[model samples]
Target: MTDHIGTAPVRDGLHGGGRRRELAAATVGSVVESFDWNLYAVLAPYFAADLFGHGKGGVNGVLAAYATFAVGFVARPVGSYLIGRLSDTRGRRLALSLGMAVIAVASLGLAALPGQRSIGVWAAVLAVVVRVVQGLAFGGEAPSVAAYVTETAPPRHRFAFSSVSYGGIILGSLLSFGVLTALIRTLGKSGLENGGWRWGFLVAALLGLGAVWVRRAAPESEEFHRARARQRPGGRPPFLRTLREHRRSVFTVFLNTLGGTVGYYFALTYLPQYAAAYHVIDKETAASFMTVVLAVVLVTMLLTGAAADRFGLLPVARIGFWLPVPAVPVLLAGLRGGWLSFQLVAVLLGMLVATVLGTLNVFTGLLFPTEVRAVGLGVVNAATIAAFGGSFPLLAEWLGDHHRLGLIPFYVTVCTAGPAVGLLTAMRVPSFAAAVQEAEAGIQRTPGSA
Candidate 1:
């Protein structure tokens, strides 16, 4: 069940408390990455009019902003593939650092850009370009962090430890929400609407630099070093050949992520996007509810991680995948005329999604040997996210506009259950499951494992 090309297990060269340091570096990258990416979503409503349409924050402006958001997703696959190759070739530390720097540049560009009123159509053009750059940079962020962080874990606690990276995501979301909420109180909605949102972008840019600085001091994973050592002059085959050998594993990653990606994006964006486009919820209330959900989800993620560590990844992840099916219908039902109850529904959905996010790296990280783990997760996960998660808001909005809102639940249901189906299918494929199981065993035997 090991790598067909004769790979050795990854034995790290750690001394002292290197594992904690690596986790911190990866966690910071996750925070900055989440801050930079989610900033656009959190503040898009306030800034959409200024940068997007005819100086009015209406449906069209929101649509235009979301379109730019989707455009950013388009660049993700390319970014992940390139960064995956870079990480596999150079080092995870280098790749993670590079992505953070790119995000910083994009954040600064967004912070300083002129709005449509000031620069006309060129403002829109610049926004799109900046988002695309940001998306491409962010494409590398997750896989690199996942590979770096999870590889440092003991096999026994890998799931719980994996939560650290995603917990960073929730913390970053909280930071974005907290920052914007403070600005709203200080400057008022009128101020944010009048261009105060730019400050958030500036802060995000600064944070990105901080993440890069932290990453610079972090050590590279010993697992990566072992993989590199295995690649003697004549030892490894062509990269494509290596990929072909593990194509089924890559496909498993894709299926596993299909619904998981969409569910995460949908849970995070739906209420806000709906609030923006239709005005069903006010900005402040939306922010407050999201903050609450994020806090709950953060704690829930850590607990789920611990659960997976105890019950096994597949079992815990199954709960995440299936819970969304029954929950989405109720959530969509609440959206119809029950504003007071929507917060409860949203929290439920958020917790379900967090379960997936929390244990995801364990599945992806162990699906391949150390040599291709980053790229194996990177390319497939990015492609699935871009295709489903990126395009979701536009699709949902279009459906709502057409009065076909009833269909939305069906989509969400299917996506939430996709991973379960994928896992079931993979169980029948001896090679794919065996590969993951094989890596799982090796991880337990890793340097720091209990």
Candidate 2:
């Protein structure tokens, strides 16, 4: 099962076309899930005035809108716990289907909900509620899908396969950017304010439904089935078991994700807003640039994953996390000046961020065994993403408003530094990949007795 790339052997019972189908289902579902989740952020500025009203209060209104977006992150950890437990107890296919169903309903809800003019603050309230639902669903969806892909992939190809989920995310963002750019050109600002933003959400809802249908036929991960069968009846819940037994893995993942999530949000999600807010670029231009940046990221992500398979995960991950440390400051310096310089530096930084995230999902999945894999990743990812990823834009906006724009790059540098240090330190201990292989071997040996 081992390959020339030095990846562990592929697990039995999942090979050939069967594995490809599972990866396809998982990738499509991820794309749809991310599309639904990111639609609001992509269209936020266009819809802000409608949802929160206009005037000087408009600035506060946009912030409020972003705050509502962050509210979804607040619900992620809860979703992670509940859904992760469900995935461990039930099955990956069921958990994924249910998560996609929630995303579909939530996206459609956002699409159909009344605006502030029609319902006053209630409009914002309802939006927040829908975001929470989406957040919860995503909390479960991301980790479960990552685990499923890793478990089912040919061992040598796990990194590449796991990158598919990240690819879906980038593709989703690219789709959002394309839709937004098209809407801007066709609708203009007024039309977008009138009702055009809803189209994005509506489209996401449809795609989510399509993803659910596709996922319904996906085969359950063989590894999950084997792991579940190996668990003793009435044993402790997976979450608790994970906390007690895999504390180091959980902590390591948290530190690693803190950097990756922060870098991702800072570099990709908030870049357009940052450019617009600081007058570095117009909104339209920023969106166009972001579309290009996302395309670059998508390519870099896949390449980094492939590299991880050939080289070692630690070395690849180290390069990803460390490169951004020096690059962030240089990019920020460029942003303070000419547009051409800013765009060049920004693209370079975007690629660096993509490199980190490209390998991160697979690396995180390798940190835990099948028994606690889903919950372990869900909790750690949910926690970091909520705390760092969710707050990134808000924090950047706040800093910009206060004339502390200089602090932004430093913030990004600190975030990246922590994970770089953690990765280097962890490399000295039991390797995460080896630990994962050992755990899998143990499961194969004792089919009904963990």
Candidate 3:
């Protein structure tokens, strides 16, 4: 509620308790938004064919819907550039509020959309369009939240605070699995496809309003205010210029991001579908396992955050880096074996991957300076997410249908290795620290530097 737009306020409550509180508020809002966005993926298989199908091949139509699901990731970089620019020039708070508003509206719109029986192909088109809007909002959300947390928290706790941004993700997963479990219990199978899915979206729409309340309570970050106060000449760096100069940092981030995306999507997004397809688990059982796994994921997320604080980002990232190399193969083996063992192994794999991703929330937040943090996070995340996260489901679906299911672990291994190598190399680079210093320097030299 207090505005310190043109000057750095005295390091009083706002810089201390007030700032952390506001950052926490922002993180809470982000978690709610993520819950809304991700809830759809869990329910996608049920709704996609039912509503989006062309009345042709039922399951095939559903598969097409999943493919369309990947299309949203394509817009992430575009959204990152557009939204990230707006956040930098305008303000992180404004950018986030606008993004959340857009997502809220999109969720409500999707809730109201007509199904295939009612509108035919247009329904599918409408769904895709709304999803693209959601993707755009998401593209901005992660970076904006990460930047806000890092800037607002005390320097010593930067990694700890930033981890909260991804904690929101785990929170979302928890809410999603919990909500779906309850819905399935009440609605039963037919109710699920016929009316339950729509209600699920409605639940997301309602949760979105919580973001508005949280953002309202959020106080802006000191770093942003500081940058604005300096008001120095020629302080702004073109996005591309920043990238060109810090090419290695950017690559490291991309790779770091890649590892998280592949591991996460493979475990969270594709696993349920894979389990159901192979009859390894029934729909309800799969949902239950997912819910339980997510609970474990939530716990690991917090531990990883604390770990980052105690140990630092590099070491934590390294653990995440190599832990999954062996874990991936074991994960697939469990899935292929049987339902009971697969569920147990699935949870274990989820925990391992969760640790890797949990580490990322802090490290990636620290990667860029406040000036372009949103976009930097956005670009790297967008690229890696699009390449790995978005394509994961579709690829898994294809591989499964073609009887190439054995390749799943190999695919995960390849993707996981990309970021592992990138991060390890980045640890050795001289410019990693310099990059952060340069970014901060640019901000201090900017107009009205705080």
Candidate 4:
């Protein structure tokens, strides 16, 4: 009970249909986030040279293409600040809808883009431009959607609501894989290689448009309205001051989420590629294997979300961090095991580590007061994703290329190690809701003191 922080008293001012609207918005946002981001990762092998190379530049071309992928992650902080600020001041619905529209435009542009053969280096340049746009959109989209779901859920069901809403990440990735696999099979490898990959982005663009409509239909949170009501009409506080005051919360969000991002990008999104690259299986088998693994992960996420509601968020999340410490080392121990051998262990860890992700957005959003929840979370989580998630594949490939696979487990362990202590210290020593109340009431507590 002590570890279980209480939900906000201002949960969901609107009821019934309003709750459905919030959940739908959150789910669609998660799906779009997963789809467009992973579309590149999934389709990179086929399209990387088309967009980045001088023709059959080998693995080096793919590597160059993914650099743009990393750049996109690096661009997220800018979007987070711009759109997160919008979410807090205007409304979550507007921010969510706007972010989706950005991604939709980016996706459509990428789908229509000509390859390097036609456009030269500008093709790659334009690719980064599009990805940066997506990163910015996602940067804002993620936090706004997270805050909306958390604020709109009933207090007792916050964990479950957050879990169910964010489960769209898995659904999105699954659909991505399914789409690609079907394309590979129907078109055969040559047809896909020729130009079939663009269809994936075309699909992502359509989904982004649909998500924008769904978010528009979703209701705004009562919590944000109340926070705005308390604000002096023409006297909004400067964001710089809010950042300075809430610096501790931002750092805490970093510690809590860094590992989860790595797990999702590496263990889940990158697995099919990792397996195929190492000769463990062909792309089709790897994709099929991951589809099954992700289905299990989805079920596991829902179960953990329900568990968090029944037990507590931190208790459930602590297991998520520690489970990967041992599991990851075993996966790459020999670095050449069969699919049923070490690869299975890797996917298992994927499912387990995802528990933290199931409720992470909601937990992070709740760590701030309603007034600044979207912006702070957007910035910190985007930074964390940029550092860990975006660069994970590159790091793994670099280590594997140099035959240093053994160190990867240590890297994953180090990432997961901080959160157990940091979340307990930062979120629950005095608690987030408590800190927000104290700040509002002009009660000062020294930073970092227990």
Candidate 5:
């Protein structure tokens, strides 16, 4: 059956009506999680003075603040390992609910905390503790959602189905941007600098209420339920053993994620900042540009998800990957022009990146079996995201600082090529197709097959 948004068939033998609910649940969950995470980077610049010791040492203060942000990222893999095991054995609902709860509490903690001026270094210390919780919660959240969606959908439409989950990321980003823009308008620069940013965290905390409702309402996937019923103690393979047996798949996922994740942050998140930092535009204009770009990304994400269902994940992913090689130069040139050029590039090339990134979980989840799917997806994503995602902002800052910004293109090239090559190599591995078939055959053998 087709989803309301598109003509793609439901996969994993999910009932047409039930599949809709599951998709909605996963999509909403993804959006809530992404909104909280993405907002931190964009909002950090305004609040750094109070939180990160901005005047204490000039540039070093900002670096220390960003370092704290990076520290949260460092905690994700640990979150993934702990949460993935829980989702794999206990339940997706429990794992996701708990993670979201932790984020909500941390956000509230941040909202209520005093700034360094009022509370001394203890304020920063408290902020770091909250950030660690946020990091751990987000780390487990994505992989579990991916695994749940992959197993829940019908096989034929799995990729397309998975694409829907990514829509939440774009949706959340746009929402966060909208909220930030509103707060800036209402409070102005001084007001925002003082405490308006704290309101953003409060808004984030409120989302947990919606997340809880969705989690409670959505039923567990029937496939997952069956897997639990047939549980065999000690029969489940160790994560390392399963990962070793499927090392090639792990490598392929890492390569695929490395390019897509880095490219995504560059185009959607980092580019506008680049424009502002280079004096091409002012802060408001840069934020506005990114907000518009994210809006475009949101629309494209939904369309890409639908397309992935129709064409299969790999083919659509390949098209998204290769399209950027030509567009990157154009984007760079456009950025050199003015606002219109940047917007044009944002709409065109932004869509290209979203196509692949929007459908990443669908493809990644299919690469592993149930035994290690969560752990495998988590590790690969964590590694690629940590290396690529964290590095881009730092690299951009470094290049700009040195006036060697032209090197940015080479950086993009390497990021794009690494994944493209891995994907191409993955296609040739005999086990890729065989594993997919085996998975399908297992489903077919199930009683009533849903």
Candidate 6:
């Protein structure tokens, strides 16, 4: 059968060696992006006193650092618009390379920055600036990589390939926590606070540079090349056209993302900080727990992705969404009890969230056509994550201060419900992926096409 004008020909289940090379590059690029973005979370406790000057250095100091962490996400939406547009207009390979370059620079800046003792508040200011740049880079990196992986994979294996993108994030978290655990074991608390944390940022910088080189050598996706070739001489910007034509798709993707974002941040990323703040566990213990949680999540994610390929995206997504609603309250109750319970429940929660993330990348990629897929996914992802995911740490901190910590599980439950409902509504539309494919075909057949 002949291929569609702007689409690559579908292949069998097995991928060629060249396609495998593209996957490896995208995976490494994603790992570097995740490491750069999340490294601050692991080190925040040690640096909070020096950077933010929170009195006697307790929960308040950690909260201040987390606040700075949250501020970084504020730039994500703007970055998504600018960099996602670049991917649409230029090429995925260029966007991936450029984002990694920015990440490397920002990671190096963080490693070299002086504390408040040297530059006073400027140290904090500089930290936030580097974080913003990192956020911007990540905003571009995720969608382009996801789109590239999805568009390049064979129809029978798209979910399996796309799932590897999220696996990079799990591995990045594991690496960050593993290094922190080892540092605490070797250097002890005071030593880490004094200077040891900088090494982690330095490692991230080196990894980011390596990923930039890898992505630079990777080939551009055939789908992107075909779509670019068919662009009209003068037309509306892809972002604007996406808004005008694909509003429902954009909204569906946003709703689909809400549950996974809230669950992952609250359950995995912020849990360590919360444990340290409440004195439920030492920093080293928290790091150890997260290391284990990440290992479980990585395995679960790969399995869930394969399940999506075998069963269906919507079925896997629905299971992921609803299972967590009841499980969260029970886990939170366990968390309030003690450290052992916290570790066990946290691992279970991570696995549940991984199932959602497993299929989400492919589901969102199929929502838009090749021409606007990157920007559409990026804009929706950045907005929802900034609004809900990034703010969860700060919000939980405030709630804990107000003696309302028990409400967090209920908040997560509500967020999970949105995706379950949104996805069911989305499936009601007949052949949603087919509709996107047909739209791309229509664009290719437009009059005066190249």
Winning candidate number (lDDT): 6
Local accuracy of candidate 5 as per-residue lDDT tens digits, 1-450:
112111123244445667777787788878888788777777777777778776443365555666667777777888888898888788877887888888888888888989888988888788788888888888888888887787776665566567678778878888877888888889987888888899998998899667867777676755566666677888777878877877877888888887887787787777777767656777677676677888778778777866655544456667776777767766776676664565676677678778777767766776666656677788777767766775577667667767888888777867776566766766654545554444346445653332
Evaluated at residue 222, the lDDT of candidate 2 is 70
- Candidates' lDDT values, in order? 0.77, 0.77, 0.71, 0.76, 0.73, 0.78
Task: Provide the RMSD of all predictions against the true structure, rounded to 1 decimal.
Answer: 3.7, 5.2, 5.9, 5.7, 4.9, 5.6
Q: Write the per-residue lDDT of candidate 6 for residues 120-228, one digit (tens) a residue.
A: 8888789888888888888888888878876776655566776777789888988888888888889988988987888889999999888888887788888887777
Clashing pairs in 6: none
lDDT of 1: 0.77
| Candidate 1 Cα deviation (angstroms), residue 270 | 1.8
Listed per model in order, the count of residue pairs whose N, CA or C atoms clash below 3 Å is: 0, 0, 11, 0, 7, 0
Query: Per-residue lDDT of 1-450 in model 1, one digit per residue for the tens?
Result: 344321223433334366667778988888888788778877877898899865344457767887888889899988987898899789999999999999999999999999888999899899999999988888888888878865666546667777877789888987888888888989999999899999999999999998889889898876677679878766645557766877766777787788777777777766665544445666577776788888888899889888766655566766776777777777766675566456776788888888778877666666666777777678778888888888887787678777776687788888888777767766655644665465456555663442
CA displacement after TM-score superposition, residue 83 of candidate 5 (Å): 0.3
Candidate 5 deviation (Cα RMSD): 4.9
Candidate ordering by lDDT (highest first): 6, 2, 1, 4, 5, 3
Residue 133 local lDDT, model 2: 89
What TM-score should be assigned to candidate 3?
A: 0.88
CA lDDT, candidate 6, residue 183: 81
TM-scores, all models, native as reference: 0.89, 0.91, 0.88, 0.89, 0.89, 0.91
Worst 10 residues of 6 by lDDT: 1-10
Number of colliding residue pairs in model 2: 0
RMSD, candidate 2, Å: 5.2
Question: Lowest-lDDT window of 10 residues in candidate 5?
Answer: 1-10
Candidate 3 has an lDDT of 0.71
**Model 4 compared with the native: what TM-score?**
0.89
User: Model 4: how far is 22 from its true place, Å?
Assistant: 1.0
